[model samples]
Target chain A: MRSWKNHVRGELQQRDQTEKLPFIGVFTSLSQMEERFEFRKTCLDDVQSKSLDRGGREVGKDTRLLQLQLRESEHLAEKLSQTVSDLTTVLYLKEAELQYWQSRVSHFRQEALSLAKGSNAMKATLSEFEYTVECQSKELAALRTEQKGINQALEQACREKEELLQRWMEEKREEADRLNKYNAAQERWQRFAKQLKKHLHNARTKEFVPIVTSSWCGEAEMSTSVIQRINNTYRDTTMSKL
Target chain B: MADDKDVLRDVWFGRIPTCFLLNQDEVTEREAEPYYLLLPRVSYLTLVTDKVKKHFHKVIRTDDAEEMWFEYEGTPLKWHYPIGVLFDLHASNTVLPWSITVHFKNFPERDLLHCPSHSVIEAHFMSSIKEADALKHKSQVVNDMQKKDHKQLWMGLQNDKFDQFWAMNRKLMEYPTEDGGFRFIPFRIYQTLSDRPFIQKQFRPVSPEGHVHTLGDLLKEVYPVALPTEGGPKRFQVVIHGIEPLLETPLQWLSEHLSHPDSFLHICVIPVPSD
Candidate 1:
């Protein structure tokens, strides 16, 4: 009886160690604990039956021993009840902890799903933007090339216009210089013609007066005609200047 | 010869090819031919108009043909202004003749109707002149007749003196006759400038002086209503090809800065922060 009690105590100690390992270890140790509980119940029943048989054979001598055995069995029953209560308390705590962990995992999963959806939307917009940027850049390059060609043509036209204007100015200056020279020459010629006309008139009056009184009418007419002819020639030349 | 510097040289005038009709409805392309007048530069437009009238009378034999006036591209020309000034203002070259249209006096609405033959029209016109002449006294008629006959006395006057005298006395001599009307005619002149073409541009009003307008004003004038208004501020950029952006510049200076006579200007506009 003493050895059986010691064995039961050792078994209970082993179950406690197994239960304390972790929540996962608790499930494996649950079947072992049940087996030990059943063994303890049967051992108590056998010890009670042996105590009854010994009381009938040696009533006076086994009375004190039987009473002591009764007290020890009661003590063992209290210890088993305490251990069972402790195990129930451990199971409740483990269940509550498991429920909390499950809720946290579900919340994390939902957050990940939402973040993935947002990433997909951003990627779609990014690709569209990239395509538009590429097309615009190509168009810009073509436009720049055309603009360069136009600028070159404009520059050439401007240069040609400037050159033409310069040439026109030079020609105008030459014309003005020629006009001034011609005007000066015309003034000199007019003065010389006037002096020549005066000399001819004086010569006719001073030298031909006596000749004219004689019958030299034909000579006088010829001189006058010659003078008129010369005057006509000078007038014609002056008119041409205009 | 004394006023030779004031003489007009290389002047040009325009003549309508056919007799002008008094009715606006009778105007046609056939009469639109612009003939170059071969008059001397010193000759006045009045001489051109008189010559045109004589040619029409000689060719058509229509005694009651209405009087005509000259218009250049719809602007009526004054009879006294020298044709040279007109040529200078409109045409760069002196030789090219101007284009003109001849409009008749009160034809479509009033005169020159219901006449059958030349004799009847002549008789009617003669009776009107006789009636007008009879209304004046014999002494006044003699004085007017002598003045008309002695036009050659003043014909050799210088152009400036003649123009001034005519400008002042033209209204005095044009007194209404017994028929309550007067006879007047105009002659148009044109000269085409092939080498130097004139270009004019009007800007949108922007300031109190009315010289400049914003760039948006130009865009609005060009495109009637294509822009959409948003709640936010709208910004746009203009890019002129071969030139810098033309923002915040005075509208009066825009044409001078961007334009040359020979080259074509290209412009581009872009909107900012498009949604």
Candidate 2:
């Protein structure tokens, strides 16, 4: 009986070790435990029948003890199966949680990759914008300098125009003065010409009346040269008086 | 005046039998059949040639096609002009069933305005009406009309509904009885001899002395050469709506009866057909 108890203990220890091996090993060991319990039950039945036949009180007590030990081992196996079921449930839950975390990790990795690509594109765009700004600023500076040059040219042209205008006005003023002087001289010359015309008409009438009166007195033969000399002397006297 | 109302109906219902033939140079998958249509004289060519386009489209490759244009003999037809004006100006003396060559390439940009779509036609038509109103009523009548009324006029012409068009157009033709006629007659005279497109001038329907102006008077004032010299050969024929109306016909009556839907008297002065 002691040896049987020791063997039962050793079987329980082997089951425990098999349970620690793997899930399949635990199932195999469970089947082995069932087989051993059946065998031990058969052996107990045989021992009980024999003890009954012999009508021995101590043998029946031993058989009852063996039955008690077998019952205890069955109780231990039931408890161990409950623990295995609980451990399987915990393992399934842990596997699900690990899968969920792995998927989350992959999603974060994708997000990080996309963010890196976006940043690279943004950097390129920013550099392009900066280059355009630099080119635009340079063009603006060149335009400003060109505008300044044009302004100076325009100012110089304006100054030259003003100078030319002043010179033209002075020349016009001088010409106007000369015209005024010439007009005055022309007026004086006209007056002198009018007086000379009147004097010539008067002298011609006076000389012609005397020549007509002398010709009427039959002085036709009186030398024509002498009349011409008289007329010349009278015109010279009229000019000197003017 | 009662007899004159028939003339307006006759003018409105006038149609010309036209034959549309594809040009020889166009790329076609098969021999294109000629399309025959009774084109409305008062409408535009581009507005009435949808069937012609479809018939030709069946035989022509889509990849080689461009904006469709038309030609007769050799001259590219200007689609902006009324079909009747185009006929009277170019094909007045031609044989029946006016043959026009359809082209899908080589658009004559210098000779014709691009149609693009039906909206362009609408815009052109509306602008013409407004211009005529400006001449007739100082633009008072057209401006006073509602948007739907204007749409009615366009829709009536587009759908070939004479009553619908006339319902809105009658208002544009009204004038004070005491004034005897419109403020000015909107008229354009086209001649084939000159490089000028047309002659447009401000002309009154009545003389200052209250004498009613006649078609002859309008022609004499604007183009004296269009009239036959006394006891001389007729050098030109003054055509309106494919007929030579008597010179003594009152200009006001002609304006009321003979003017196109655009409200303008388009006169074509073509050389006398020698044959």
Candidate 3:
């Protein structure tokens, strides 16, 4: 029994040997120490239980709020899902409209390009026509200038012709005057010739009378006197006729 | 037509000297000189009377008392007889200087229209004037016939109607060639203000059909230098001094319009204003 007791003391003393606490080693009896240890354990157990109860109460409150919030989130998620479906349909329709607009824009672009080409051709033709008009106007101006030169030359020629004509007319008038003078001089010459012929005839008749008188009678003085009287009468008559 | 041909054959023109003796009573011997003139064979004695009046330096008065009539030798020559016929009868051997005397009725002695003595015709002044009137009418007719023939010839020549031209102009071209064909009558063109004297161009004896000759062609031949060098073509104006029938006509057509007794036609060239 003493050995058994010693063994128990040894086991119990073994805890003291292993533990270095002064107060714990100062315990009078093992039962009292055990009672104190049991009391400490009980206190620790109460504290742990109270703490556990407080944590459990808090968790219960959180779990209830979380449950309500989870329900609301589920409802919101369903509404959001419907909105997404509707938005997806709208996106599909808009994509179709966008494709139609893109096709129209392409068509309009082609029309604009063709119109631009036509305008460019028209501009070229208009420029060519304007160039032709400018050339024709220049040609017309040249022709007008040439015509003016020709007109001036013609006027000059006419002036020269007029002067020539005036000179010719003056010469003609002079010729006519000379012809008149010649005719008058010719008339005076003819008159002189006629008078000379008359004189010669009278002289011949007077000589014949003297020859006859001298031949018939040798009375020279009387014959001479009669011939002189006859010559004088003949001269008077001839002068009277003239 | 045959009669016209015969008359053309008989017609002759030559220069003759004419004498006028008007103041025979005042001057015992009127020694007036003679003036030369061209006369046709068919010239009337009335033409002689006119010539005498023209040369006498006396105004020809138609009034009976103041008028003068012509006498050949001592007797009054009848005016109705052609000068050629009278020469054939009275003086066939006489050459030129055909003498004629003028008898004025001595104004206050006796009225020429109312003379009484008609046997000798010394006072038959009124009868002589009437004969001269008839002769003038006949001469006018003959002149008109000749003018018509000339116009026909000219028209035919201008239009190049050779047959008609030769038919009408055969008598005018009566002088035959050695080949027994007729020659074209020679004509001349004289320029007014040109340095060259004259241009002698011959008319075609026979013209081709559809050919026409104008004064413009004649001007081109005569005044080639007057043509335009540049600009529009030049036009020439032709004027004739004595022509009255046609003015500014073709050259050939102008031949018939020449004055009486003119040997050749005279033409004046002028430039027409362009404007």
Top lDDT prediction, candidate number = 2
Best by TM-score: 2
Estimate, for each residue in B231-256, the C-alpha lDDT of model 3 and write its tens digit: 77655443333111122233333333
TM-score of each: 0.26, 0.53, 0.20
**Residue pairs with backbone atoms closer than 3 Å in model 1 (clashes):** B98-B190, B206-B212
Candidate 3: lDDT over CA atoms?
0.45
DockQ of each: 0.00, 0.00, 0.00
**Candidate ranking (lDDT, best to worst):** 2, 3, 1
lDDT of 2 by residue, A1-242 (tens): 33422432343334323322233344346546755676677767766776677755446586677776876687679879987975675576457646755876797799889989999999999999999999999999999999999999999999999999999999999898877866775576567657666765665666677676754333333434545665577567556644
Which 10 consecutive residues of model 1 chain B have the lowest summed lDDT?
B1-10
Give the alpha carbon lDDT tens digit for every residue of A82-163 in model 3. Answer: 7797567557646754675587689779989999999999999999999999999999999999999999999999999999
Deviation from native of the Cα of residue A212 in model 1, angstroms:
19
State how far residue B128 of model 2 sits from its true place (Å). Answer: 0.5
| Per-model lDDT | 0.42, 0.80, 0.45
Instruction: Compute the lDDT of residue A104 as modeled in candidate 2.
Output: 62
lDDT of 2 by residue, B6-51 (tens): 4566677667777899999999999988876767789999998886
Give the TM-score ranking, best first: 2, 1, 3
